[model samples]
Target: MTEKDPRYRRAASAVKRCVAGEVFLVPVAAGVADVMSLYVLNPTAEVIWDLLDEPRSLNEICEHIQQVTGEAGGHVREDCSNFLTQMERMGLVERA
Candidate 1:
């Protein structure tokens, strides 16, 4: 997906689970068992992860972040965009 695109959701091929206070993402595929690795989300990222339970536009996610953290809209948008980009690269998320 392009960096300008904000409509995304968690990829179906990955599994997400919350253990303790952290969120873990694991790939689900044959032969992945041996190479499987966990991707953990930080507190802020956890919030974004949950928000992505359904397909959502980047602007919508940033709006929720602003409401929850009271951060400036521009800052929240940038942070969320960056986080989404990273998650996409890891195959944890995909364009909706």
Candidate 2:
């Protein structure tokens, strides 16, 4: 699909903010104590995470990034779509 499906969504306040020096992810499932894990994301993945702070559709995110960076550089949209899909699979985002 040229445009992303509008059903994708993200969990609210699910991400814990930490110091800016380094980026890390801590996944803590509610009603399931002692099941926390920390995930380390690379620079590109970190960018995706930052974008995901708000519930934005994949297409919208890609467009924003392209506009902000002033360079698609080729395949940015596809890369962003893939990143968004991965985030959804990782439970970092949900489908609305």
Candidate 3:
């Protein structure tokens, strides 16, 4: 992705909770509870989630993931992109 790819931040109304060493994204709004389901993030997703506590570019997230997991750049980029896209679709994250 290019630098033009927008950075993302956690949604204003979403709350994060940890249970049994896993992180979950909980939507908190009147109709949100009914419409949006809670998202349980895996260990790798948890790393991305923590990095997303603030606005960050996809490249930045990929770099961090690579550093943390010692993975290949292309692999990390694809994985992070997919995760971010899913989170954005679920309204857990927004363009920053």
Which candidate should be chosen as best, given TM-score against the real structure?
3
lDDT, candidate 1, equals: 0.81
Candidate 3: regions farther than 4 A off: 1-3, 30-36
lDDT of 1 at 32: 60
lDDT of each: 0.81, 0.64, 0.83
Q: Largest lDDT belongs to which candidate?
A: 3
List the lowest-lDDT window of 10 residues for candidate 3. Answer: 30-39
RMSD of each: 2.9, 3.6, 2.7
Backbone clashes in model 2, listed as residue pairs: none
Ranking by TM-score: 3, 1, 2
| Better candidate number, 2 or 3, judged by lDDT | 3
The deviation in Å at residue 76 for candidate 2 is: 1.2
lDDT of 3 at 89: 89
Candidate 1 per-residue lDDT, tens place, 5-91, comes to 559898876776777877887777763632357887777888888888899999888888898888888778888888998889978
Which regions of candidate 2 deviate over 4 angstroms?
1-4, 31-36, 42-47
> How well does candidate 2 score on lDDT at residue 31?
39
Q: What is the lDDT of residue 33 in candidate 2?
A: 23
Better of 1 and 3 by lDDT: 3
